[model samples]
Target chain A: MAQRIDVKDLDIYYGDFLAVEGVTMTIEPRSVTAFIGPSGCGKSTFLRTLNRMHEVIPGTRVEGSVEMEGVDLYGPGVDPVAVRRQIGMVFQRPNPFPTMSIEENVLAGVKLVNKRISKSDAADLVESSLRGSNLWEEVKDRLDKPGAGLSGGQQQRLCIARAIAIKPQVLLMDEPCSALDPISTLAIEDLIAELKQDYTIVIVTHNMQQAARVSDRTAFFNIAGTGKPGKLIEMDDTSTMFSSPTEKATEDYISGRFG
Target chain B: MSTTAPPTGKARSRSASGRAGDRGMNRIFRLVSTWSGALILATLAAVAIFLVLEAWPAISLGGEELGEQISWFPEDTSIITFVGPLIFGTLLAAFLALILATPLAVGVALFISHYAPRRLAQALGYLVDLLAAIPSVVYGLWGILAFAPIVYPVWNGIAETLGWFPLFEGPAADPPRVMATVAVVLAVMILPIITAVCREVFLQTPKLHEEAALALGATRWELVKTAVLPFARSGIISGAMLGLGRALGETMAVLMILSPGFLYSFAIFQAGQQQTIAANIAAQQPEAPPLGVSALIATGLALFVITMAVNMAARAVVARRKDFSGAN
Candidate 1:
């Protein structure tokens, strides 16, 4: 089951400094929304806050509200751990739990919540997840080999399988293809196209062409100067954002004028 | 060691002499480093060879007499070359100390690395270091006079309550200078080394791996179980072996706290019954007859062999971990 997200006037901070300010947006259910920005513009920071992962850093905090289907994730007594299970994240660099095998990496999130699993159910989950990420054909024979033994592109796909296994309502990608080659990047873009049919997907990217190619809607974020908080410049239909005039900054960023 | 490329284009002539000077210095440094390592290995080999040479007479005895000497041990006191009791005593005391120290060391290591606040963790770590810095002689004197008085009664109480168990069935003495006393002292002495090493390893678990666990909906304890523990397993084994090495070869603390007799008992609670090989050497070497000295050297050689074997075993365990590894 997919979930819609409504973020209202959200301010993110690392310790005393405000990192990103007054972000208000709605991410529709079962749709692909891409966030594109210059480096250090708080695009990745904003994605982490979606899953309550921002607070994992010491002294980092968030203000205002991030609601998933009208339930405030940061409300008192709402556990960050529970918030994370509802929204899974794939990091920029693929992380496949170096200690685990490919099958184990796929089942890691499910196993984290349930200590004991029926063998048949575990096998089914692993197969379906790997198939969903289009990695099962490549890795089905050597399922017990260490996840670290895979190439960078395959490792990223394995991480996707791991993320999908948990059955999270919203899937967050923080520049998932930035570390990948063109072929791997294309593979992920195709996977995103299929994934949005069942899950609400929000991806952050530095590549404008990728945002245009994969996203239904695009949100542009920008930083004014060093030490200044990043702000959301504009949100529009991907076709409209690319072809029509909006803000001067968004036009500059997308049209290769300047960051 | 220097394989520097020649300067190209305009700068080639200007840099030529400087590159030659650098290469000359690198060659000299490499030779010096190689000689330094060779000298250390040569010194260690000399010690082992000379020990065997000096003890040759006692070791070369005919079959029956050598066999008798090995069995009667230091207790015989005539012809005085046996060592079975000393070796067994050393093993029992060190083994007991290892069992006592390992769990406590790991707990302290985990607490400092993961659970404690930054300031508190530093203070606790410093306190453990202080435990190591206390001279062994001070540890010995404290054990004999202050520590023994406190633990003697506790040993007696354990003997009374759990006396049916052979290990607790102590013939508890007035001063209670037993193998158990030596073990507790050794555990205290080795605790700091094990704790320090394990703490460093736990701290080295990659931040990426830790965050991966957190994002998988794992609680803090689950994160430690999944990531930290697997990563630190090899380090933990090596740390424990370091402590075990110290316990095996310790001299002064065992000399002062344990009563020296040739008697052997696997029973840890028995008082006034044993002495380790290192303690026997320190106490007997000065005034020992020539034959006694030879016997001591032979025992010393045995201790060296045992320690080397343990180090080899540790290396094997640590090496296997790379292939069977759960962590990068």
Candidate 2:
């Protein structure tokens, strides 16, 4: 069974300025959860805190607990490296290691972390990971080509394959389809539905329709003004939230009345 | 209505004049910019041509005596003791300096870019900049009065402990300035320049690439080793070549630190047996006979060729780097 993520009373700060304040949410296991909001609304910050990736930035800190499968990710003894290994992340842009080949990029996590896998096992892993991401047929013949040579959509799928190669329990995608064309966006959305069967996935997107189409549950966040912390406006099942959100602010944002 | 029509025509004429004035100013700016660029290139070309012309006589004279048995002297008691110990010493010292300075420069660059706090890194950077501004004569004076004396005991200790090895054997009497000491001083003097250039290159690494490495569960050291080092490898090589050029042309510091002789010997510990070209030029150019002066110029020509080759190699590395970085 896969593990669920529970973020409790989370507050993120950049130096002395609070970016997100007192937000709490439970992300169900084996389901697709979406965070949608305007720019600078702290959706990305909340997502980064789930895997302790927020601490990588200088002067950035997070308060409160993000627990995964009963283990507190921010505990004193917890290694953020280990936490990130279990909870993989994809960024807004597709950043495959330019120096590595397509095949090498897919197997980077396994090769970098575990040194004992045999050549045959590694090959099998690369094939299965690429197939799972629906990129095997497109890139199978050119595995030795550099990852940077691929098109924008192909590179994003390559990053997806790289993330899944380690078989992480949770995958975080920050606007994975934002940089893709319409056709690529549909392909990624379809991949998300299939991926939910094996791993918990959380995505942050500014595209409200993407949230409505792909997520099992949606959380809408908004900021009051400049220098104010972002706050969660609503969280519910996908259909109810899109059709009839409980909060007036969520309805106003969804209807394009105001951001 | 007739009066208004004349006033409107006057306004149109005024706007036309303003547009013409702006166009004329733009043309003047463009011409000045183009001339400035051409002037800079012309100055560089002139300097290169002048050096070659001044050094031509020695080059031709040395070529004529290439097959001589002893290279005893040219015409009119002008000793043509060319292609001997000193040129070899200069190359060896520069090579040693490169070996010692490269790793330290890269390490300091990595520290400043990835590890140090902003204020502290800025302070350290200023300190390095100050090193480049310090006068070469002051460095020579410091080497003679302070560095040599302080480092003498350490050198002597190594010699005493490892005397059985050929490289560590002490000289017969007083320990004089040798190749090893000169190489060490050169390394110290070139360290700041190399580190500065390398730091700038390392800082230019894309932030997204670094974040991607971290998000893949790589430790900080692993991230640097896998991503940062590989990405900046060519830039670091270029920076090292730049440092080597400086070390090769350095004169006053090497002259003050080395007890240069005209004999060629491979032994590291022997004093007054090794000398570099730059130091030799400074020491002998004043009292040298005409051919001796030409021989020194010939040596200068050799140094010039070496520096040009290094710069060309550095340019090649820099040109290929963009392809490696996937920027093309």
Q: Which numbered prediction scores highest in TM-score against the true structure?
A: 1
Model 2 misplaced regions, further than 4 Å: B1-41, B62-81, B156-176, B263-266, B320-322
lDDT of 2 by residue, A1-259 (tens): 4589888898999999999998888999999999988899999999998888888888999888889977899999999999989999998888888777889889888877887989899889989999988999999998988888888788888999999998899999999998889999998999999999999999999899999999999999999998999988889998999999999989998888887
Could you estimate the TM-score for every candidate? 0.91, 0.88
Give candidate 2's error at residue A45 in angstroms: 1.0
- Worst 10-residue lDDT window, candidate 1 chain A: A91-100
Compare the candidates by DockQ and give the number of the best one.
Answer: 1
Clashing pairs in 1: A99-B326
CA deviation > 4 Å runs, candidate 1: B1-18, B62-81, B161-166, B171-174, B324-328
Candidate 2 TM-score, true structure as reference: 0.88
Range of the 10 consecutive residues with the lowest summed lDDT in candidate 2 chain B: B69-78
Per-residue accuracy of model 2 over B1-328 as CA lDDT, tens digit each: 0112345778778767778777789789999999999999998788778767776766665444532422433333222355455667888889888999999999998888888999989988888888877777787888777777767677777777877786667742245477777777888888888998899988987787788788889898878976788778877887898889989999999999888766656555567777888998898788776656666776787787778887897888767645346563
Clashing pairs in 2: none
